[model samples]
Target: MQLIQLNLKHCRAAQDLLMQTVRERGSEVAILSEPYRTGNSQGWATDRTGKAALWLCGIGAQQMCDIKAADGFVRANVCGTWLYSCYLASSLSLESFGRILDELSIDLRGHCNAVVGGDFNAWAIE
Candidate 1:
């Protein structure tokens, strides 16, 4: 299965771009973060594949905690699963991001195949 992950800036253009990318790639699963509103909003419609999932990390400080509290940090165990997780971050930082990943690793308990895709506001060199 193909998993497409993106961090939308909550712009109409970004949303359009994400949709266009999904269409072009024929993605079987898509995960998006931020910018995408929740509940009864057009943002939810972007998941055209129906196979897609949205992770709306709340805004500001809550967003930071949300990321740290996410349980779907590892993707191996989350792939092909219908479970969708979203975390929002107010400021992107290495330490903060790493902590979130650490939490995720703990949450997944070393499982790394379940996740499909979503915006992880971290840069790791592997």
Candidate 2:
């Protein structure tokens, strides 16, 4: 029942660190960021924003582990109105992004335990 939150900053070394933590703590649950927005095929299994979170079942939970591990992972697109100079000219719309979230939440609920990790792109005041 241990939970750890990490901001991986898109470093490969961080994955190694996570594995170490899992070994030491017998941790079955973990969350990591894939900052570069690379897909899982690009040597990284990450969310749409290049961030990813992982959860592992602790020792002696073979049955639980046998279930899909992806069930415990969640990814949310946090890219909000704060557009960088590079994206300023892009045609992506924030309103469309919001719709995606609304649609995704429905399907995602059936997949995993009630936990969410990844860049929310949400401001504290918002």
Q: Assess each prediction's global lDDT (C-alpha) against the native.
A: 0.45, 0.41
Residue pair clashes in candidate 2:
28-56, 34-50, 34-51, 37-50, 78-120
For candidate 1, give the lDDT.
0.45
Q: Which stretches of candidate 1 lie over 4 Å from their true place?
A: 38-99, 110-112, 116-126
What ranges in model 2 sit over 4 Å off? 35-50, 53-57, 62-92, 108-113, 123-126
Best by TM-score: 2
Q: In the order shown, what is each candidate's alpha-carbon RMSD?
A: 10.1, 9.8
What lDDT score goes with residue 50 in model 1?
A: 28
Model 1 per-residue lDDT tens digits across residues 1-126:
555677665667887776677778766444665544434531232232222245322221211111122332322122224434444253647676667666655665543344535555454559
